[model samples]
Target chain A: MAVIQRSRADKTGIVIRYVVLAVGALLFLLPFYLLVRNGLATEQDITSPSWKLFPSSLQWSNIAELFNNPAVPMLRSLINSLVIAVVQTVGVLVISGLAGYGLARIPFRYANAVFYFIVATLLIPAAVTFVPSFVLVSSLGWVSTLRGLIIPGLFQAFATFLFRQYFLNFPRELEEAAALDGTAYWGTFWRIVVPNSKGFIAAIATITFIGSWNAFLWPLVIAPDQSAWTVQIALSTFLTAQTIDLPQLFIAATIAILPLVVMFVFLQRWIVAGVERSGISE
Target chain B: MSTVTTRLRGRHDRNLWFLIFVGPFVLGLVVFVYIPILWSIWLSFFDAHNTVTPANFVGLGNYVDMLADSAFRSSLITFVVFALFIVPTTFVASLGLALLVNRARFAKTFFRSVFFLPTACSYVVASLIWKLSIFSGVRFGLMNTVLGWFGIEPIAWLSVTQPPWYWLVIVTARMWLQAGFYMILFLAGLQRIAPSLYEAAAIDGATGWKVLRFLTLPQLRATSTAVLLLLLINAFQAFDEFYNLLSSSGQYPPYARPPLVYLYYAALGQGQDFGHGSAGAVILTLLIALVALGQGRFLGLGRRED
Candidate 1:
């Protein structure tokens, strides 16, 4: 009798759990739904008191209008954003991967000290470097240029530390076999280590790409010129009081965030796994 | 083939390896992060206005001035208030979401990804969506539309500051954007807890609430502490959403200004007092350091465990 009662209770429990979760999911997804819905709505439709979740007419022209918004240079800014994210990701992977491999694999005097220094940098608040980094970049005439956006952020201490931690736990037999076969350390890394670390690389690259794409404050400070602005910086210009073009702004925001949404959908597994791996380090 | 020559060659190879492996990142770190931090500290001591270099040496003047300035003081207060509101609420929300997601027997990935999708979004895009489409101070805004179903009148969700209803917009937007990431963190923490502990407690006649309190919560202490510390740090660094949402009208409202936004205004906005900005930055850093150090003290961050 008790077992039968407990089974019935478990069935209802599962039902209750799903019901609650479905509601929570709706709450979480409401903004994105509104973004897409309103992006397809006209300014008249958006501002009208009558409410509809779906737009009566899809404003496909809004996309064209956003891209051609002369004041913002949406296309140019998108290209700039792409370049910054791609270049920054590749640069960080190479720099951090190599430094991480060295710190973990190579036995050198002061390696631990160097590792500690890199980790120490992680503790310092980013605000400390904000103004001075701008000054340093400005002094070098990098403001309003991709060089300013890309170079200053190329080496991430956290990414390097992540790579080091990953490498520390990596099995050493493969590397040992390579060494026995007369392969050098760098060659072994390029041939064996790099190939084996595809998952880690993908995880880190995805995160770095997302972060670089979404970066605001640094780019906001350095790239005020429309020509040099990233997509995010360009998107913010729509919110300026004088030019509150609602439809155009919604469409532009859709364009800005679309890549990330798509990427998250496809690469969801690695991103989650990557974060788990990093969390384990703590 | 002499011993000394062989030793010299070995040393040369090791040095070459070091140079080839670690040189680029160390060089970038030194130039970009370390030196600039030191320069910022130096710049804080002088009356450097708009320029990196100073014409006058004013020790403690900038810090004192910033403290005395009402705008800066109020901005700091706003930051604390904002953090206080965000940190605990997100902790509960994420923890709740984590537990719910973990309990699911099906579509776990679907629920997890749906919740986490917001974490991938740019604050700029999210803020614009909230400002223009959702909390828009209009009768047609999303929230207003829902409220209308309840026979309520149109309310200005973003503009009402006397009761600070704008906080609803700010807090919800931030919570929506961040809660998912923390949920992921908590989910990771939850999975790390061994299943045997729950089974063992159940065998001992402990049911749902008791098993959770005894088995789960105790195991989650480390992850929970880390999550809180991270939330605290990220809260103090708040700028993107607050700036984009509240200051969409071009000028920041006094009610919603956080330290970073305020310092931006003081130094780069009309005031152009770079030294004052650096001083504010230093003070903010110290506050962050204090929080980090206090957390680290109990967490034993500086200790060598291995």
Candidate 2:
């Protein structure tokens, strides 16, 4: 009888835990649900002064309307965002990867000092360089171009540190065997190291991609031209004071987050581990 | 003779390899990161506008002006208030979530992903979702609809700041986006704790609150400290959501502006005062550095694991 009672108590505990979790999950999901619900609602339906959960009719065409709107340039901005995010991710990976490998594998005389300097730069707030970086980019006449968006952000101190830490654990035998076969440092890195370090590279790449895709302030100031504006900057254009199109704005937001949502759903394991790794040091 | 020549060639090759491997990143860091930081500091001391070059050398004038400006002063207050509200709320919420998820028996990965999905959502997008869809002043909106169900009158969530209910929007949006990430950090910390400790505690008849207090919380000290520090830094970097949701056409209301938004307006908005912006940036950086340093010193962020 006592064992049965204990099992019953355990069942109740499990039920209570799930009940609490279900409520919390609803709280987390409510915003996304609201976004989709109103995103397909008519402007009149949305603005009407009556409480309703779902629209009488689903306006699936709102997505088309958002893309068709000339002021937002949704497609072009998406292309711009894609270019910026991809280029910056690739650039940081190459730059930081090379530096990490050099610091970890190469026995250069001043490697320790150089690594220290790079890590110290991570302490300096991005705000400290915010305006001057803008000015420098502008002075070079690179503003409103992909070069401006992609170049200044190509090197990441945190990502470099992450790479260095990972590389420190990399097995030396493979590289040594390559060296014994007369493979140079560059050749070994390109042929063996790069192929072997794909997991770390993917983790770093995902983190960098999300950051680049979501970047707002720098792109806002630099990419003044509609053609050069990223998806984030383009989404902000819908928020002007003149008129607030609720459906259009929601649609834009949905579109803005859709790629990230998809990426998260697909690569969530790496993304979560990457975020934890990034915070583990600091 | 050939061995000596080969040794010399090896030295030459090593030097070449070092430059090839490390030179690009170093040069990029020097020109883009270090140079801009120094230039920003220099610009803070002078009167600059529109251009990168400071037109006049005015030592401490911009700093004095920034301190005197009521807008900038209030922004500092606003940041403190926001940070105070967000830091503990997030810490507790994430810890609670982590503890609950840690004890969950089923669909652990599913629960983890559901909570963490928002961390990947961009602030700009999340802000719009809150501002436009959920918290919109319309009676038919999400929050208002829920209120209607309780027979309460519709509330204009984004407006009416005498009591500053708009903080609801800002606070909830940020918490939803960030709490899961911290929860994952806590979960990672939780997983690191040895099961033996918990088993030993249960053997001694410690259960419920005692186990949590003695075994769990103490074990998570390092992770908790790191989470708190990261939260503090991120709180200071508050710009995107505030700017996107609250700012109208790149101009912000005085009530909701944080230091970064205030500095953004001073530098980029109609006034275009780059000197003041740079000064404010420098001040903000110093404040963050001081906080981080204090936290590190007191919390032993750098203490060796003896």
Candidate 3:
């Protein structure tokens, strides 16, 4: 009878634990709900800011109106952001992956020295290089194109270091067996290492995409005209101290932020795993 | 002689293949990173102009002028103040959010996504939302509208430098954009905390608040340092949101004239003085390095952990 009573108490404690958790989760979710409701409202709704937790009317015109804004050029901006993020991710993955493989799989003198040198650059803040990089970008005649932005960020010091660590954890027996089978090392890399490292690749892809999307300093400096501006640059349209387009701007931001949020949601475990693996060896 | 030649050929082939394997990264770094850094250091000493002309050495004049400049000094102060508020506020808020999300039962993923949405936001986009939706002083902006319910009059949010309400706008902007990213980091740290510790605390007659203080904070120490240093560095590196929020005209000193903004005004916005820009860049670099190194020491980065 006492055991039965203790079990009931334990179940009650579990229910109480959930209640505490639910309230806390609500606090975390409030701002995002505020953003979504605000985004769907009309221009008039933006001006008459009542404390309506949900939108009174689903004024879907804001999205089209945003598309219609001449000064903004929405479609072009989306293309630019997508192309830059995609292309940069591809280039970064390929380069960093190859470098990682070489350090991990290859037996070469001075390999450790080279790896450390690349990793050391991670501590040097990007801001330090901002001014000079701008001048250098212009000197190379890459000032106005997506190419300028894409090329500069194509390989990161940390990404190379990250890939190296991931590759080191892979088993070497497969590579040895491939070598003994009279297979070339490059073929083995393509068939085995590249296919096997999808999780790390996804992790890098998420980091790079979000990073490219949010990148401000270089994009602001390099993109010569409004036509070439990334989505991030286009989203800066709500800039009045006295009066501003609240609903439209919020909607645009929510849309802009959606891709990364979705990616993170689907691959949450990979990211958690990635964070654990990164820089711990140093 | 043929045997020796074959051996030499074999060694050459292996070295060549090794280079090809690592070529992409090595080549990219040399072209993009190494060259840029060396050129940046070189250009810091030269009076560079747009025209392809002979660059003249300006010696230490640029650095000298930067030290004398009031705007440079103000910008540094502005950044320091920003870091002071943002680092602690974001860290605590994220930890709180992580604890909240960690305990959630129903639709936990959905709740995590909602919390993380703002962080994924592009800074310029987020800043635009803040500008239009929230602080519009016409009594119609969301924040002002909410304040109206409390009988508070609509006041200038970012324009007036008095009591630095303008500064407050920047801080809030940073806080909203940053909170979610750190929450994820804290969540990762929280996952590492043994469940047994929480159970032990509950059994020891510790209150919820005490359990949090004793259990969570100690466990999250490394993550706390990471968050603090990252926030401190990022706060000083504030460019996008600050620029988009303040610089509508792209030519003037944006808003109340932060140091980077002021430096941008001098270098790119008006005088087109790359020399002055270099000076500003060097000083900011030195300041950031000093702080980062100090934090590294505080974190005991050099000491090997067991």
Where does candidate 1 chain A have its weakest 10-residue lDDT segment? Answer: A273-282
lDDT of 2 by residue, A29-75 (tens): 87888778778989888877775677889999999998888766889
Once fitted onto the true fold, the runs of candidate 2 whose alpha carbons sit more than 4 angstroms away are A1-6, B1-9, B297-306
Off by over 4 Å in 3: A1-39, A49-56, A237-251, A271-282, B1-14, B49-54, B105-107, B195-215, B251-259, B297-306
Instruction: Name the runs in model 1 displaced over 4 angstroms.
Output: A278-282, B1-9, B297-306
A34 Cα displacement, candidate 1 (Å)? 1.1
| CA lDDT, candidate 3, residue B304 | 20
Best by TM-score: 1
What docking tier does model 3 reach?
Answer: acceptable
DockQ of 3: 0.41
lDDT of 2 by residue, B1-306 (tens): 445434533766777788888889999999889887788888888888776776799999999998898998998898899999999999999999998899998888888888888887888888888887788777766788888889998788876655467888898899999999999999999999999999999789897789999889999999998899888888888888888778776556768888887777788777667788888888887787788777765233222221
> How do the predictions measure up, each by TM-score?
0.95, 0.94, 0.87
- Evaluate residue A151 in candidate 3 and report its C-alpha lDDT on the 0 to 100 scale: 93
Chain B TM-score in each of the candidates: 0.92, 0.92, 0.86
